[model samples]
Target: MTMSAVVMRKGGLELIETPIPRPGPGDVLVKTLANGICGSDLHAVTHGAELVDGFRAVTGADPFDLNGQVVLGHEFCAEVVENGPGTRGTHAPGTRVVSAPFLLREPQPVLLGFGGVDTPGGYADYMLLSEDLLIPVPDEVPTDTAALTEPLAVALHAVNRGSLGSDDVPVVIGCGPIGLAVIAVLRMRGIGPIIAADFSPARRAMAATLGADIVVDPRETSPYDSWRSVAAVSDPARFGRQTVSFPGFGFRPSVVFECVGVPGVIQQILGGAAPCTKVVVAGLCMEQDTFYPTFGVLKEIDLVFSISYTLEEFGQAIGHLAAGELRVDPLITSRIGLAEVPDAFARLADPEQDAKIIITPNAR
Candidate 1:
């Protein structure tokens, strides 16, 4: 039997019918329920061909060639339909679940939605997931909300990498889904007053709803000025010139989350960071980006590049959702069926269009 799926081809995404994938040893077959459209998926659609070159430049090795058909989706929630041969019944059939997107086969890493062109992902009606990567979603958490587990894990991982302290004031640099997720995670951890910046008015508002203490439109006002103003009112002595430290200068954000993965945002953060601040690059930038090393050196800044989350972090994300500690319902802007994926992609390309567009493959 064949299944319907939205496939990423050389030209663009295409809705097509393909054979339902069977799980191999140590794998489980899953029926896709809900899949969240991620910024990485958009990047793959627009610049997939350049990904190989980008990876080569970064790691001095071509990770994978995406010159063929690829199934694009990583943030998703599904139902386990079958357990393949040689797999223990750790997760029984009929369990709702989500998984880490990385498929490690021997010496190489195959990213579920991006690296392997033919690897079935959440964009389809069915998918084959490694048993090791599967994380069960609690009964309290709906599949639609569980679809956010992956990105929330990513946010948690980035925050973990930042090593935030209870007193550390975090300034999130983007209000996109990932950036918003960062804000949510920060709130759950009781680490605030969180400051977030974004050029989009809609995103800034969303950030405020997600618990950002101060949301600023970087276009109209400098985020640094906003941070300083908050710091001045909160604690004037801490903002004193002589006592102010490096990296954060007079600001209190010792840890900055760079959620906007663009060309010049890192440089902007570097220039604005005080002497000893830690900047976490949580956004996925598939293309080349440059930042002057001197800026980091002068400030003695610690730059941490974070990618996918750990297995433990993935489980934690699900737990947070299950306990109702994380709010993802607000981030879901629209829901579409499989056939609407191509059009949804087009709509999402416009930065001002929507926040998170979820594809309900089985929805009639």
Candidate 2:
């Protein structure tokens, strides 16, 4: 049977009809219900070659060839169709599920819908996922909300990496989906005084709706400075003298999440951050970035970078959605069918237009 899918070509995305893939050993066929457009998807479409090079550098293997077209998608929720050979089919057919975007392979796992054309992602009408990776979505969780498991898992992982303390202040420097997810997760955990900053007014408002205690426009005031109003900081500017021997000595240490992956942001955070601050970088910056290590050292800053999530974390994200502990309705700004996926990608360029766009690939 043939199915429609959006393929990433050298020039741009192309919608075409292709045979629906049959499940392989230890794989299960799934019908795509909803898939969220991630920021990495935007980067992958434009920088596939660069991504391949980076992959080569990290794993010392060239797994992706930009010469061939590939499907791009990761965050998704689907329903079980059929179980392939050597599979237990943990979930019954027609059961809603979400899984980490990994297909088990010999040496290492291949990304479900990335790396090459052979591994199609959720951009298609149907996909084959590793049976072991599938997690059944609870009956109460809607399909669109369940699709958010991957990104929310990403946020949960980032928050875990931060190792926040009860007294530590949480500051998210970018009110994008990932940033907003972090805010939501923090609020779900009962973490308070969450500060979110963004240049876009729409995003700032979303951050507030998602449970940010304080939302600031970084253009008018630096995010580092805005936290002082709600929390105590050993500020030399306020006291006319450095009260603490080091950064964050007299007050709570700020755990700043660098969600904006553009260049120069790390450097800016290092320049303005308080002493003994921990900066967790969750954003994926593809290009080369510059940051002064000396500044970080002088301020006693701990810089950490985080990516992806563990299987446990992914399941936890789904559990949170099912229990209604995390409300993600505010982050979902638009929903489109597979035909609109291309235009939706274009609309995402303007932050004011959308926060999260869910693509229903099988929609008629």
Q: Estimate TM-scores for all models.
A: 0.91, 0.94
lDDT of 2 at 148: 94
Residues 127-149, candidate 1: write the lDDT tens digits. Answer: 88888878888898988899999
Q: After superposition, how far is residue 309 of candidate 2 from its true place, in Å?
A: 0.8
Question: Candidate 2 at 1: error in angstroms?
Answer: 1.0
Clashes of each: 9, 2
lDDT of candidate 2 vs native? 0.86
Residue 54 of candidate 2: its Cα lDDT?
80
Off by over 4 Å in 1: 59-64, 104-109, 115-118, 232-253
lDDT of each: 0.82, 0.86
**Residue pairs with backbone overlap in model 2:** 113-121, 247-275
Which portions of model 2 show Cα errors greater than 4 Å?
115-117, 233-244
What is the Cα-based lDDT of residue 201 in candidate 1?
82
Ten-residue stretch with the least lDDT total in model 1: 239-248
Candidate maximizing lDDT:
2
User: Alpha-carbon error at 90 in model 2, in Å?
Assistant: 2.5
